[model samples]
Target: MEKVHFTEEKATMLATLYGRALDSREADPVLGDHAADEAVRQIDYDFAKLGITRDSAVSVVLRAKPIDEWAADYLRQHPDALVLHLGCGMDTRFQRLAPPETVHWYDVDYPEVVELREKLYAPAPNHTNIGTSVTDFGWLDQVPSDRPALIVAEGLTMYLTPEDGTELIRRLVAKFPSGELICDVFSKLGIKAQKLNTPVRRAKATLRWGIDDPHELERYGLDLMSSLDASHWSTPDVMARLRPFTRFQLRMLKYFPALARMANIVRYRF
Candidate 1:
């Protein structure tokens, strides 16, 4: 295997077999992505480079399926809306959403990720891949200010300082008239605990923002929408369909969203 540089979440999600597992979601709704093929390749590259097996990644991704479904649902509501995937990495969301030809999609990222995306996954007619730092505003100018936007940042916030996260929201809201943003957050305490964990600490990746109060995002621009816990996916009917072990976790997830917060999904709108 070739030595490679793998981004943390990218490797983690891939290890979790995001798309294959997604295929198993009978009622889960998100447009599926064709680029999922390439994302798998990228994840394999990273896993080999990082010297870790794929097991842990599977656990994390399976635990976070609700977040993926949420992103897909947002795009369905605003099909013509501009879609920006910040710090996009290898996520195949645009290919999955496959927005209407009328919609404009921008995948913003560091040069390397963008290059990889371009080399591995071809963009659809409606899609545009921007190889630039999300902190830079170059791609925003490409979007029409008249239309609203749906911005999705899966695991990018943790890499940015709190001020940068706020500024990104501020600029995104200012540039797009009205829009929805869906992202995840760590509490400051959670961030610290992650730092102290030897394996994660060795990765040298920084965890930037933790929200004791997720509501603080409103100060930047977004309005809080409904908060979600895994229970949002469950019911007595679904419970009847699950295996004994699967049902056990969903039951735990319902009353125990906190346990699910080793990773989290938060939704917002501006």
Candidate 2:
């Protein structure tokens, strides 16, 4: 078994990884992320201590499904695209998508997280893992700027200060010839209410940036293509697969716009 030494913000990744594993074990799984299940089993850590619930696990998959679909769609359009998966927390999206060999995939995170990934996942033909904080500009130098890039930053933006997050978006948009940026964002209200979230609070991770308006990002050179609130992120068919309480919560998002828009999956094209 691989021993883990993650804590604080890093430990938050484990909680998400375990949540995906939990979803994979369900009778009618949302993500069916068997690779995550396999990774959880291989790690020598007590995931039970994280206090993640079944409903929350399903919620995790709900947020992830759209991002997965968007990434897959991008790959279909640009088979030779460059994928910059920022703050990738042991997600098997690259494996799940199985993009064409021409696609160059980069999985980036903190050095230790990347090292942990090296142990858990096998190397693929056109994949590379860069071990550095995503905010550190130097890592961008290693990636070629010649292709249509797809930058996916799931459950990542909220952790960055507004300056860092905005600058990151600007740098990414300016670097690629042209492509898309897909990321999930929490509203300012959501950031204030984050302490109520168990796994995040347990990990002692803090959220810094909260985007109330996605259009503001357009000023950085991106044009908003889609901004899906929590309730709309998943398709009707996928929504039907969720548990009752989870369904109720999503339904409430319609009645209460503020609650519904507490979080969103936004897509932008430069």
Candidate 3:
């Protein structure tokens, strides 16, 4: 297969997947994503340029674990629900979750990303691939509104402007009668810190939006269920197996509330 050429923002998606794949290769893996590992092997790219290290791999995979858990729970509750994975990238979440056949899965992203995804993934009978930016509300019409929906936006909100991100949430809440949204957001401080984030800087991607308070989503008519500091709540079990110095640094970060607030995993219901 020919190598995929993605833009800066789109390239970051591949970087995260590679990180997860690297983590999965460890003796005791946190997010055991064998599919990601396979994709990394099949795809031709220079991973070293992405600045992904063993330490960063743990952090990236840990961020994705919460979304997987939340989506899995929602699918169990609403077996026949519609799952909309915004900014899906090349993530194999649907494969990992393995929701019931009754669930309809839609992976939405930029055309280039979706095209590459088609090469790497085969959708189930109930699944569809949508090539469009999340900001475009046109694609929403294609999705059925009768069934409850579960929307997941991982590592996506930061790239959008506040206006665009909030509008996307508002549209989703308004479209689905009873549904849940699980997404991660950066704080204002976190947006500033992105400049120093090696992976993000390496990808030449800019972080444009952030939310310091979970209640901020309420402004857009979304019912904020919970917003958790990822550094504290989403630490993967495998983290304990890391070097003592690494574990100590992560533990220290947990005690610093200001620093901890940098990234959060939030859940909202409509």
User: How high is the CA lDDT of each candidate model?
Assistant: 0.63, 0.89, 0.87
What TM-score would each prediction reach against the true structure?
0.75, 0.96, 0.96
- Which ten residues in a row are the worst by lDDT in model 2? 233-242
155 in model 3: Cα distance from truth in Å? 0.3
90-133 in candidate 1: lDDT tens per residue?
A: 67666555567877888888776677677767658888888777
What digit string (tens of lDDT, one per residue) describes model 3 on residues 1-270?
549777678989978988889988998887899999998888888877898877778888888887888889899999989999999999999999998899999999998888888888876798899999999889999999899999999999999999999889888888888899899998999998998778889889999998999888888777888777856653556667677777777787778987888989999888
Q: Ten-residue segment with the worst summed lDDT in candidate 3?
A: 230-239
Pairs in steric clash, model 1: 16-58, 32-96, 33-96, 186-210
Q: How should the candidates be ordered by lDDT, best one leading? A: 2, 3, 1
**What residue runs in model 3 are displaced by over 4 Å at the alpha carbon?**
234-237
Candidate 3: global Cα-lDDT?
0.87
